[model samples]
Target: MTIFKRGEKELALIELKNITKCYKIGQIQVNALNGVDLSIENGEFVSIMGPSGSGKSTLLNVIGCLDQPTTGTYKLGDNNVEKVSDWQLSDIRNQFIGFVFQSFHLLPGLTALENVELPLIYRGILGKERKKRAIEALESLDLGDRMHHLPTQLSGGQQQRVAIARAIVGKPSVLLADEPTGALDSKSSVNIMSVFQKLNQEMGITIVQVTHEETIAQYGHKIFRLFDGKIEKIEVLNESLKAIE
Candidate 1:
C-alpha cells in the first residue's frame, strides 16, 4: 500500500495534457473526454472510477492507443501519441500496452497455453521460445496446471487468470484493464485484484484500471474520479491492500 510520490523520482509513463475526445452522431457532437490532464508514473497502480457514460472507457482507449484524442497531447513513454503514424501506434500498442477486459476474451477453442502464446506469435517469435514464455507467464499467475484447459473447462477466476496471462505474456510495459473484475464473484474479484497487485508490486508493470466499484478501486494507489467526462478529483490512498500471499 504505497501512494505514488510526486517529484523527480517518479517517471511519467503516461502523460495527458488537455486531452479531449468527441464523437459525432447525427449532427450532434458527444464529448466523451473534456480537457482532461493526467500523469501516471512508472510502476504506479491507478484506478479511474466513474458512472457509465463518464468517459472512463474513452480515456482508457486513448491511454491504451486504441483510439486517438480529438484534441490535445498524449505522451506515452517516449512516443508522442498524437504524432505517431497508425502503423507506429499499432506497434506501440503491441509493445507497450497490455489490456485486460471485463470479459475474459479467451478463445473457446484454444487451450490456456495457446491463448497466452498468441501475442508472441503475432510478434513472430519462434515457436519454441513462444511456448516457453507463455508457460512462464501462466505459471507466474499460478495457472501452470491449467495450461491445457480450455476456457469452458476452467472456472470464472481461472479463465480470467488465463486472460491475464495472455495479456502479460509479451511483457508489455503497462497494463490497461477496463472493469477487469466486473464479471466475477466477490472471491474471484479479490483473487484478480491480488493478481494485479502482484504484477504491479513485484513485476514492476505499471497498471491503470477503470472500475465502478469502490472496493475494486481501492486496490490502486490512486483513484481518479470522473464526472461528466471531466476528472472530478484524484485521491491518493493511504495504502493498497497488501498483496495476497
Candidate 2:
C-alpha cells in the first residue's frame, strides 16, 4: 500500500520547495516570496498570519494556483504546478481548489442559488443537477431561505455564507480563504469560524486561511507566522481547547 494511504508522512496534499516570487517595479526588484518551503497535509486546518509585505497573500495565491512562483516547485497531489500550462493549471485549480475572498464576490444580478451554481456550470454539469447541488449547499450553510435573494438583498454575513456555500459546492480537496471574516462584525465572525471548524472537522476538507487577526487565527489547528516573506514560527493548538487560553 502507498504510504499516503496508510496516513504516514506521505499524505501531503500541498508541498512547496524553495518557492520564490520576484516582481520588477521599474528599476527596483522586489522579492515577494523568498525561498519558502512548506507542506500541508490532507484534512488539516492551517492559518497563515503576517504583516503587510510579509508575503502571506502571495503564498496563498501560489498555493491556490492563482499565481506561479518565479522559481522552485509546487506540487498539488503529485502534479507539478510549475510545469503545467495555463490551461492545464486552470483545469487543476477548478478540479481541486475552492476559494473564498473577503469581498464575497457574488454576482449582483443573480440570485444566491444562481450564483452558487456558477462553478457547476464551469464543470459542465446540467441545469437540474446544478440547481439541486446549489440548493443542497445553500441549505448546508443555513441559507436555504435566502436562495432567491440577490447579493444586495442580504446582509454582509449572509452574503459571505452564500460565497462559502458556492465555494464548497464543488467538493474541492482544499478550501483557500483569504481574510474570510475581514468584512464581518464580531458575532458574524464567530459564526463563520464555527462553520469553518465544522467543515474542517466533519467534512474532512483541508482548509488554508490567511488572516491578520489573532483571534481569528486561533481557530485553526496550526498557525504559521510569516515575517518578511518567510515563516518565522509555527504553533499547533490542542484540539480539546477552544482557544490557547
Candidate 3:
C-alpha cells in the first residue's frame, strides 16, 4: 500500500510521453493508445484497469518493449525504445523486462525447474549456473519441492507460480503482467497477489499489471484507469489495508 510519487528519489524505470499506437483494421485506422503519458519508477506496484479495447494491453506492450509506439518517446531504463532496431529491442526485453501472462505458458513436458531455466538458456548462460539460478527462483516462490513436477501435474496456483519464477529468474528490472490472476480461483488469486506483494516490497522489483477486477487491482499501490485509449484517472488506494501476509 505504498504509492510512489515522482519527486526524484529514483529514476523512472519506465517512461512514456505522447504515446500513440495505431493499427489498420480493414482499412480503418484504430488507435489503441492515444497520446498516453506515464511514468513508473523503480519498485512501484501499479495496475491498469480499463474496459475492453481501452489500451491497457497496448501500454503494457509498449512498456515491455514488445511493440513500439506509433508516435512517442519511450525510455525503458537506458534504452530509447523507438530508436532501437528489432534485434536490439529483443535484447532489451531480455535484459530489462520480465513478462507474466494470464496463461501460465509452461511447456507441457518440462519440469518446473527446467521451465524456469529457459530464460537463462536463451541468454547463453552456462548450464551449471543456469540450473542454480532457476532453483533459487523456484525456491523463493516456495516451489522448491515442486521443481520436478510438470505443468499438467501441478495445480493452477502452482503452475502460475512456476510461470512467475521463470519470469524472474533473470532478475529483470520490471515485471509486466497481463491478467496474471485471471485464470485462478479466488483463493489462488489472493495467493498470487501476495506473492506479487512480496516480490515488489522485498525483492524491489517494479511490477505493472493489467487487471479488470477491482479487488485484484486494489493490491496495487495506485490504479490507473483507462477509457477509450486514454488514461481516465489515477486512484490511490486506501493505504491502511496492508498487503496480505
- lDDT by candidate, in order shown: 0.89, 0.88, 0.88
Query: What clash count goes with each model?
Result: 1, 0, 0
**Tens-digit lDDT string for candidate 2 (67-163):** 9999999888766887778898788778778999999999999999999999999999999999999999999999999999999999999999999
Instruction: State every prediction's TM-score relative to the real structure.
Output: 0.95, 0.94, 0.94
> Global CA lDDT of candidate 1, please?
0.89
Q: Residue by residue across 107-161, what tens digits does model 1's lDDT show?
A: 9999999999999987999999999999999999999999999999999999999
The C-alpha stretches of model 2 lying farther than 4 A from their native spots are: 1-10, 241-245
RMSD after CA superposition, every candidate:
3.7, 2.8, 3.6
Cα RMSD (Å) between model 2 and the true structure?
2.8
Give the winner by lDDT.
1
Task: Report the C-alpha displacement of residue 225, candidate 3, in angstroms.
Answer: 0.6
Segments of candidate 1 deviating more than 4 angstroms: 1-9
Question: Which residue pairs clash in candidate 3?
Answer: none
lDDT, residue 95, candidate 1: 76
Error of 2 at 88 (Å): 1.0
